[model samples]
Target: MNKYERIKAALNFEEVDRVPISLWMHLSENDINPKSLAESQIEQTRKYDFDFIKLMPFGLYCVEDWGAQVQYYSKSNQPPIVKKPGIESIEDWGKLKVLPAIYGTYGKQLQLAEHVSRKVGGETPFVQTIFSPLTVARKLAGDRLLLDMKENPAIVKQALEVITETTINFVKANVNAGVDGFFFATQCASEELLTEEEYKIFGVPYDLKVIESYNKETFFNIAHIHGDKIMFDLVANYPVNCLNWHDRWISPSLAEARKRTDKCLLGGVREAPYFDGNNKKIRDSLLIDGTVVEIGNHVKESIDSVDGKGLILGPGCVIDQQTPERSLYAARRSVYTGAHTLV
Candidate 1:
């Protein structure tokens, strides 16, 4: 099967020729400017013949459109910064301005997705990333948002309503721009951070609304849980066709997740402490010696246990830009080889 066909079949929860392998490459402005990262991603996928290419346009820019300040780091750094917590009080919320264009960080991401999609066309499935409404709200409300959610429930609900509406519009624009699917990432709804009740109240309902809005014959959707092992069941119940999360850190292995829901499983690799060196250095020597190989082996073992069905081998979360590309290459190769053996 071609890459597109393979991914499409996997997304539908059907057995394919083999397990589909994909990566979420979050490119920086410098990488996008030179078009090197995007091009290299396409080139590498073509060379390795992987199953899918995630067009991970950063979602932080969506908050920036609401007048939050962003700080872009060097070419190898993830860009994040102090955002103006617009919901100081309920009255301040009314003063929010709608962006004339896709301003700030999100606009840049939209431009990159357009460029990459045009270049690759229909060769591979292009999945765009967007944050859940609660995630965006937390960024806008800062630490105070959580506080408000507990103390002043009415105010937090009001803020989330506005953000959810804006998110719906943002997602609609992307779907219209030729993105094949939406990788809906919800980081703030973790069980460690928010209780199951809180997630159901604030996160799940709003996010499910957004998913229902964009879910169509042309566009697919996946709910990505970035943290909290205990929240696997909650995430699995979300109204999405696929489930991507930090499997290396969380419970419910691919087999468990497959039993929990029929949705396609999209991860099995370790994230932090694996990608981030202990001493904060950028050298592979700092990583747990043989960490990459161990992870590759883990992915292979996981797929073998599942007989390479209902799985898409990948990192549990967004791969750190500083991570050596060779590590990612090794992970993909390991998954491919393991699946071929099963065949």
Candidate 2:
């Protein structure tokens, strides 16, 4: 089967020629320019031959237009840094006016997604990355969010409502740009960040609204629950085709996740060695400095972990830009060598 059909079969828990595979990372320098970002993503996808293209525009693009100051470095691999919180006080939350999805930073991302869509055509399944409303709010407010959410609950809820509306509009704009789906990432879902009660109130509602906007419009939607101690059971049932998290670093391994939900699982290779998960050292060594043979063996282990059904081989989060090119090539080629095991 081709990449498209292979991904569909994996999502549906049907037979696939091999497990679908993909990985993503930030192009910090190139991502600042629309054409350059498009070119970088396309070039990498073509080189590695991933099953899907998860568009990696800088993570700060969603909040910069809303009065948040950001510092961009051309020489660095790190994402653009936030200079200060957009919300300085409780009143600042009320000050956030809804920006049009087709204007400012949000509009620039829409253009980037459009460029990627037209270039890839239908050969590769591509998704636009969208941070959850709470995550965007955190980007704007930083640590003040927790204090405000507790001290000024009403005002916080009001702010999130507007954030949610703007995100829904953004999702619609991306849909118009011809994206196959969204990689909805919730960076603030960790228990260390918010309590279960808090996330149920602030995160889940808005997250569902943004995701539900694309329900009938796209089929390859993925919910990426970022960070450890995440509110897993809550986000597991999100309206998406696959669930991606730090499975290699956290509880509920891929095998355990299969019992929690029937959704396709999209993690295997850990993004790095030190993250909080089940097999940190082993996964870390493989991606960091492992031989081609070792990388291929890890790929086979990931596939077999899920019994090769409803699984897509990938890192829990984006891989580093410094990762060896040979390791990536090994990851792509491993499926071919490991395909026989699934039979």
Candidate 3:
């Protein structure tokens, strides 16, 4: 089966020729430019032959237009970092206004989606990365938003309303640009950061709003729960086909996740470390020797662990941009090599 066919079958919990594979990392150097970002992703897709393209737009773009000061270190390999929050005070949250999704960084990302869609055509699916409204609020207010959620609850809700509106507009634009679906990322849905009741009040409502905006419209929406100790049950029932989390680093292993929900699971790689100089690291109780054979063995075992159906081989989170090229190539090779053995 082709990449698209394999992914569709997997999501449906049907048999696949081989489990689909995809891995994403920040392209910090190229993300500042639309053409460069699109080109880099397209080039790498051909190089590694990933199953789908998950557009890695600089994560800060969601709140950059909201007056959040961001510092881009071109000389360094790191993605852009936020220098200051957009909402400085409780009153500032009330003063926040909705911005057009078609301007500034949002517009550039739309252009990127259009370009990639045209190039990829229907051969491969490309998903736009979107942060939940609460995640955007965190980016806008930094860690202080947590305090304001209790001290000034009303104003925080006002800001989130505007943020939800802006995010929905952007989601609409991406749909018009011909994206297959969205990779809805939620970074603030952890017990460590907020209690279950707090997330229910401030998080899930707006997330459902943005997701329900395009629920019936997209075919491959994926709910990516970022960070450990994630509130897995909170987002388990969202209108998405796949659930991606730090499964290797946290609770709810693939087998356990399947018991709670039937959505396709996308993980298995112990992403914290992909390669070693000596090619020795503990991954799924196996030692990696930085060779194609070792990588194939690892991938095959991961797929078998999940029973292969309803599984997509991928890292728990983004890999380091500095990861070795051979490691990625090995991942791709593992899929094909494993396919032959399974057949």
lDDT of candidate 3 over 221-253, digit per residue (tens): 999999978999889889899999988768898
What stretches of model 3 exceed 4 Å from their correct place?
A: 274-291, 337-343
lDDT tens readout by residue for model 1, 1-343: 8777787787775767767776555666454342565676678677667666676554456676676766666355555555455456656555555443265556666665677687876888777777888888877767777777877677666667777777676666666667788888888767678888988898887888778878773445788887764577777777777888877656777777777888878876655553354656443321123455665666677786567776777777766666666666666667556422322
Better of 2 and 3 by TM-score: 2
Lowest summed lDDT window (length 10), candidate 1: 281-290
lDDT of 2: 0.87
lDDT, residue 182, model 1: 83
| Pairs of residues at least 3 apart in sequence or in different chains that clash in candidate 1 | 61-106
Q: List the pairs of residues colliding in candidate 2.
A: 248-278, 249-276, 249-277, 250-277
- Error (Å) of candidate 1 at residue 95 is 3.0
Best by TM-score: 2
lDDT of 2 by residue, 1-343 (tens): 8888998899999999888899888888778888889988899999998899999888998888889999988544677889976888899999888878888889889999989988996888898999999999999999889999999989998999889899888889999999988999999989989998999998988888888899789989899999889888899888888999988878779988998999999998877675345643434546778778777777888888888999998899988887889889888898885332232
Best by lDDT: 2
Candidate 3: residue 263 lDDT (0-100): 94
